[model samples]
Target: MVLAAASHALSYFQAVVIGLLQGVTELFPISSLGHSVVIPKLLGWDSLAKAQSQSESFYLAFLVALHVGTAIALLVYFRKEWYGIIGGFFTSIAKRRIETPDERLAWLLVVATIPAGITGLLLEHELRTVFAKPLAAAVFLMVNGLMLLAGDRYRRRAEVRELVRTHASTESETEVGRRLDTLDFKESVAVGVAQIGALFAGISRSGITMIAGLARGLDHEDAARFSFLLATPIIFGAGLIKLPDLFGHLGNGVRGQSLVGAIAAAVAAYVAVRFLMSFFETRTLWPFGIYCLAFGGLCTLLFI
Candidate 1:
């Protein structure tokens, strides 16, 4: 049976807005999930918000489309890196030993992806059912802000800055995959484990993963690269699993809207990733942290 009320047909405009929001926020170290939940409520789109709270709602199916678009954008943006990584993965499997920097980085990504992949498989539904509400998401968004702030603060510690400065001066021109390959298996696992925190409605996968990478001594550029690389598979897999929903009864009335949304999401995501790669080259996470705090605080107050 269709879970979403028949009256709640998703409009094209809303689809575009939500899709753009998903694309940008998914990469910006701000919680895309949080924004998706909170924005509709703030706009008084009660039907859309109500649909999201339903387990088998059409909104959930729509989200699958958005995720697929975002994933595609990420894949395209990092095509060169992914090409090397995939080739390296297969070559290592054939050789039965990792030899190259690409091979090591590919395996490192697999190791780091395990914890979040497993956790998401088990807990994603339950967590969304329990805490996907606007009020709950707003609260968690504030917490996410604090996490980002803490990560930035940690990066600014005197010793940490000195260490990064020395490391950067020597390895400034190194390839990102090679730089990421320097992380040991244990550090990769730690970074992967940090992704679990993003299972919460307002916690950002990119934000927390980047924080973990920074904690492990990666510069902002490499940290962002790693976070995006790790997220590509996770996001794509999650969406692919639910892709059927978009073609089933759940998508009956919103197929056109979903298509438009997906395209908008793809465009927005490509632009966002391109901008962020440049932004992080010389910038820190302080701006994002502050934005999250302000936005989350305002939303929390409004919802309450």
Candidate 2:
């Protein structure tokens, strides 16, 4: 009873914090959702959890709604692009514009979504059980941070190599511009493969895929667009699977509280998305890397 009360006390704060984290961290190279899990786990969530025993898994429901909150934020923020992408799907073939990059961008989302969907389905139970361990989550958080650093380093290397190549070739500006859209199906697939690692480690789905996209020579903005687009399907799929559980637990005790938390999360996440878009435009990934490093190290110390 004492432990449950403490856990309940933590949930209110965790809601706002995690919502904000979800909003900002989702797009930032450091995984916000990953950090959400890792941070709480580090803070002795698991220990409290074990003391309580046979917990109703209402937290799982809370998490589902939290993602849904962020998903709504993304849809609201990107409504225009989504509208165009959806419209372009049926209209483009009729208009006979030979599969524009927008179309390919739409297709690339599918390419990237597939692997994670399969992987998540295969590993969901294992993840839920194992992710309860804060120390493991902390280690993964460190791994996730290194992955982001490595990605940024690799991207800079590629950009430098491309610049060198361009200087060597005396390439026309037009030709250089042409290279951005040039990533093929194979490269997109490779990025999808990069996404699988995100499931195990708390790497942002956006970060790893964006790295793969950068490696494939997509400019940062385009890579970001691809990353966000890839998220829509994965988010929707996960929500569907988790939604069934939400209702069974509804009104069972924590439902009202969880719903309240969901709304709080949604509102906070909306504001977060508003600011994060602008922030990413001007920022580098280094800050998020630093945050993950510090947070992960703290978690490791606490949990280990």
Candidate 3:
């Protein structure tokens, strides 16, 4: 269905709500895509839900715009880091060697982004077609929660063992970055491969990536930082690829709504990332895990 015919279906209030949700959940390990699919259904916005399920629809275009906003927020938040990383990337190319931490990290992120980028290019449409429904999303959300819980448990155990063996204390930001920089290319590839799971509606890109990072011996804060860094390119690329939809016939009626939603998303994303960076500094993923489990379970029962 053309968005113009049903433009009124998505009111400004819904736009704001969904924008805020996208911003927050995109950063949180709670499966933003899953929530985007399920929440509309829960709210009885059948038109919006139906639009989301379609391969080419205004809702999907709107979502792409939201992703752009989220990506911008990440870019702004990590502006300093990006400046160094981008410079390091060029420097490494000029020198034909990777010696600095920023150079290594720049290369590492490239390696880690490849698998998911290729996978998304190859199978994104097929995967979304098969699993974008509320039922599938709900199931995957539960699985995501389980994965988070398992990852958290494993991290705790690993931390305890390390503490007993070496009495290491909490890691500062610099220490965390240094540790992340130490990751070999193989480990970076592993983290990247884990991101493939997020192609399914209910699996979180950040959540799965962070879990993989944790498995590679990164603490919570470091894992989160790496996940955010990795997400920046992917999110922006995806949005950029589909950005024409916002200006084409698909966006004919919803352009204004998209703009409003994008603004809300940007603001919400900045705040959410700020909060999460601080939260992860001294926290574990247990709370998010529990929240996902409970919410996913409840949604599953209600949907069924």
Q: Which candidate comes out best when scored by lDDT?
A: 1
Q: What lDDT does each candidate get?
A: 0.88, 0.63, 0.87
* Runs with alpha carbons beyond 4 Å of true place in candidate 3: 1-3, 158-178
Model 1, which residues run further than 4 Å from truth? 1-8, 158-178
lDDT of 1 at 79: 99
What CA RMSD would you report for each candidate? 2.7, 4.8, 2.7
The TM-score of candidate 3 is 0.94
**Model 2: per-residue Cα lDDT at residue 184:** 64
Q: lDDT (0-100) at residue 39 of candidate 1?
A: 92
TM-score of 1: 0.93
lDDT of 1 by residue, 1-304 (tens): 2433442468889999999999999999999999888999999988887777677888898999999999999999999999999999999999999999899989999999999999999999999988889999999999999999999778767766555554423244432212566788998999999999998989999999999988777878889999999999999999999999998988877878888999999999999999999888877788889988999999999989
Q: Who is ahead in TM-score, 1 or 2?
A: 1
User: For model 2, what is the error of residue 272's alpha carbon versus the real structure, in angstroms, after optimal superposition?
Assistant: 3.6
CA lDDT for candidate 3: 0.87
TM-score against truth, every candidate? 0.93, 0.80, 0.94
Per-residue error at 197 for model 1, in Å? 1.0
